[model samples]
Target: MTNAVFHWPVSSLVQITDCHLLATPDALYQGIKPYHHLRLVLDELRAEAPLLILTGDLTEDHSADSYTLLQQLLADWPAPVFLLPGNHDERGALDQLSQQPPFRPERRLALPGWQLWLLDSKGDTPAGSFPVPRLAELECWLNEAGHQQIFWFCHHHLLPVGSFIDRFDQQDKAGLLAMLKREPRLRGLAHGHCHHAYQYDLPEFVQVGCPASSVQFLQTPDWQTQDQGPRACRWVFTPDGRLQWEFLQF
Candidate 1:
C-alpha cells in the first residue's frame, strides 16, 4: 500500500429529489409547470460539479414514456447521479434510466472518506415497507463500513411527515430508528416523497428532507387553501464536510 491518505470533504456532495416526471405529448407537466424551474436550478449547480443524489419518486406512474423522458432530462447532468426507489416508481424502469447495474436495490458507494448508503425501501406494493430481513441486512452492512461519516438516503420518510401521509410510511420504522440510535457515525439522512422540505432533529443524526423538484406542498395557507408551491431545494457540501442548503424559487 502507498502512503497516500484519502480525503473526502463535504463540498463533494449535493442531493436533489422528487422530480415526479409526468409525461405530456410535447413536454412534461407537474400541475404547476416546473420543468423550466428545475432546469434553471440544475443549470446553476452544474458549474460546481457535486455528487448528485436523486432520492426517489422519479415518475408519477410506472410508464415507459415517463422513464424515457426522465432519462433524456438527466442525460447531461454535470455530476454523477445516483438514484433510489420511490413509491410511484418502477424499479425496472428506474434502473434502466439510471443505467445502474443489476444487483440489489440498495447502493453502497465508498467515496474517499465518506460512505453513502442509498436504500431502496419501496416494496412491490404501494407506499413503503421494510421487512425484517431487509432491516437486518442493512444493520449488518452498516456494521462492516468505516468512513469519516455516513449519509443515509431513502425514498420514504422514516418518521411521520403529517397525518395525511403518515399512513404511507414504512412499516418497520421502529426497527430503522433503533438502528439509527446505535449508529453514531451517521452524520445525516436525506430522503424524498414528502414533496416538502422539512428538517428534523433525531437522537444523534441530522435528518433533512428535500423538496420535490417539480411541485411542493403548501405548509399553511393564507386563505385556507392548499396550493402547489414552486420547485426548489439543493444542498452543497464543503470540502471539509460542512453542508449548506438553498432553495431556489422560480
Candidate 2:
C-alpha cells in the first residue's frame, strides 16, 4: 500500500445507479415511460471521462432489449465502466451483457490507491438480503484494510431510505454496519434503488443514494404519485481522497 498521499491527484471517479430502463411487456411497470433525459446526462459525463461506477438497475424489466438500449446509451463513454447487480437486473443477462465477473469477492485492486469493494446485496427474491458467505467475505476485507481509504458499492441500501423503500432494504443492516465500524478507512457507501438522490450520515461512513438515470421518484408520502424527469450524478474523486458529487438534471 502506498503511504504517499499526493497534494494533487489527476484522476477522478463517478458513481451512478438505479438506471431503471424498462421496455414494453415488463409486467411490473406497464405504462411507465422511459426517462429520456438520461441522454443529456450521458452526454455531459462523457466529456469528463471519469471512472463510471454503475451501482445497479441497468434495465427496468431486465430484458435484452433494455440492455441493448443501455449499451447504445453508454457506447461512447470514455472511462472504465463497472456495473453491479440490482434487484431488477437479471444476473444472467448482466453477466452476459457486461462480460465481467460478479461482484462477490473481497480483493484489492490498484484503483488509484483507493480500494473499491463491490458487495452483492441483492437477495434471491425481490426483497434485499445479504448472502451469508458474501457478507462474511466483505467483513473480512474491511478488517484487512483497517484504515486504507475505501469505497463500497452495492445494489441495496444498508439503511431505510423511506417507508415504501424500507420494505425492500437490505436485511443484514446490523452485520453490514458492524463491519463498517471496524474499518475507519471507509470513505463512503454508495448504492441505487430509491430512485432519488439522498445521503445518510452513519456512524462509520456516509451513505450515498444515487438518483435513477431514467426517472425521478416523487417525494410525496403517497406511493401512487409519480414524476417524469431524467436524472444522473457526477462524482469527482480528488487525489487526497475527498469525494464531490453533483446531480445532473436531464
Candidate 3:
C-alpha cells in the first residue's frame, strides 16, 4: 500500500460511513432514502472541510452505477477523500473511483506526528476476517512505522458493542487485539458497520464507532431502527498524540 504524507495546517478528519446508497437516487433502505440523507450529511460537513474518510458499505446494490452515483456526489468535494470497503461493497466497483480526484485508495496516510492505517476488514461473510497475508502486511507496517502514533480506520468493529450485531464482529479479534496490545504507539481506532456511535476506552487505545450517513441501528439485543437522521464523526488529532472526536447530526 502506498503512503501519502500531508502536512496540513490543522490536524482534523471527518468520517462518514455506511452510506449504502443505491443506483437510483430516490431508492430507500429501511425506509430511509440513503442518497438524500448522505447529501444532507455532506452539506453539513462542507463547513468542517477536513480530510474525509469514508469507512465503507458505500453501495447497497454493489453496482458500478451505484459507485458512479457516489462519484458524482463527491465530485466537487474540495478535500482529499479516502474510501474502504464494507461487506455490502464490491472492491472492483469501488476502485474505479480512484481514477478521479478526491477518491484516493491509499491505505496509509502520514500526518504530522501520526500515521493513519486504513485496513480492509471486509470478508466472505457478514463477519470480518484478517487473513494471514493481511495480518503479515499490517505487522510489517506497524514495525516500519517505528514509534509514530498510529490510528486505525476500518469497516468492522474490533470489539463487541453488546448488541445483536456483535455476531458480525471481526472474526480474528484476538489477532488484532494482540497486535494492538504490543504496539504502544497505537492511539486510536475508528470504525463503522454498527451504524451506532459508541466508544470503548481500552487500556491500549480508544475505539470508536462512526454513525452511518444513511441510517442508524439501535444498540440492543434485537435489531431496531435509530431514527436520528443521518450522522458523521469528526476526529481531531492533537500535536501531543491525543485524539478528540464528536458526532455530527444532520
| Best by the TM-score measure | 3
Cα error, residue 119 of model 1, in Å, equals 0.8
How would the candidate models be sorted by TM-score, starting from the highest? 3, 2, 1
Report, for every candidate in turn, its global Cα lDDT versus the true structure.
0.65, 0.66, 0.86
| TM-scores, all models, native as reference | 0.80, 0.81, 0.95
Count the clashes in each prediction: 6, 1, 0
Model 2 whole-model lDDT (C-alpha atoms): 0.66
lDDT, candidate 2, at 76: 60
Q: Quick one: RMSD of model 1?
A: 5.2
Where does the lowest 10-residue lDDT sum fall in candidate 3?
A: 1-10
Report the C-alpha lDDT of model 1 over 1-250, residue by residue, as the tens digit.
Answer: 1112223344456567776666643454544444454565567677776667777877665678777666666677655667787888887776665553221233765564566778788976656788888778777777677545667788887777664565666777888887777877677677877777788876677777787777765544221212244444566544366655665554
lDDT of 2 by residue, 1-250 (tens): 1222222133466666776776632333424456354455667676676666677877776678887766677766755566678888876776655543222122233354467676667777766777677777766676666455787778788777764776778876877777677767777777887777888876768888888765666655555435555666676655577767777665
How many steric overlaps does candidate 1 have? 6
- 171-196: candidate 3 lDDT, tens digit per residue: 98888888888878887689999999
